[model samples]
Target: MDPSVIATLTAVVSAVVGGAAGEAGKSAWGSLTALVRRRFGTDAAVTAALEQADTRSPEETTRILVDQAHADAEFERSLADWAGETARLLQYKHDVSNTIGGDARITGTVIQAGDISGSVNLGTPGPPERRG
Candidate 1:
């Protein structure tokens, strides 16, 4: 709407509300005064909105949080699915293919393939020692 019209409405509402505030049954007036104070005196709307937001029903709060969690979960799943699909399409599976036997050699730290490390090396293991 027009800024001037909004200002006029705000002033009228504030005066009416300010006039009614500070007494019994003053919520309506208090709200109006709050609106005025929010615009002119101090930006109290942020504070008021925060305060009012706290009054939200427990169900509403839970619904909001649940919605957020579900969205996050779906987003994560979509990313994982996309990554797997991309990998498959890019033939990353073939990266591990070994069509010929003895093509790779296995080496180990001599960690006792047997019970005793008799002359066994205490290093990490690689592929089996065979070349096709």
Candidate 2:
């Protein structure tokens, strides 16, 4: 497996586990976990590991995943493939919103991914003249 894939998975696993472990973050955590389970339920080991992730610290969670990936070549490949697919999907659905108010002006071009599906409202549309 490529090192970058491993690295990306490590970071993602750690972040997801860590966020879900916190009390205040449980709602979003639950959503994230469900998404993972729904997306990658074919692998029993991966499912088991993810189920156990909620109880572990971020670092430990990452360690467990890394160990599993290292020990099982197929698992590693599967994980890397999942991560790439997830990233692509996220990019496809990613949304961005930008606003510029008052006399502020934005210079240069703004690059957006996902084909710029989100909004960029520079200002409100109204009558030409305004008096305070």
Per-residue error at 58 for model 1, in Å? 34
List TM-scores for all candidates, in order. Answer: 0.18, 0.45
The C-alpha lDDT values of all candidates are: 0.37, 0.58
Candidate 1: residue 78 lDDT (0-100) = 38
Q: Which residue pairs clash within candidate 2?
A: none
Judged by whole-model lDDT over C-alpha atoms, candidate 2 comes out at: 0.58
**Which stretches of candidate 1 lie above 4 Å from their native place?**
20-27, 30-45, 48-132
lDDT of 1 by residue, 1-132 (tens): 234333333333333333321232144334433533443355453334324433654234323323333556553343334323433333321123224247656564322131233564555789898978
Residue pairs whose backbone atoms clash in candidate 1: 102-131, 102-132, 105-127, 105-128, 106-127, 106-128, 106-129, 109-121, 109-123
Error (Å) of candidate 2 at residue 29 is 9.8
TM-score, model 1 to reference: 0.18
Compute the lDDT of residue 70 as modeled in candidate 2.
80
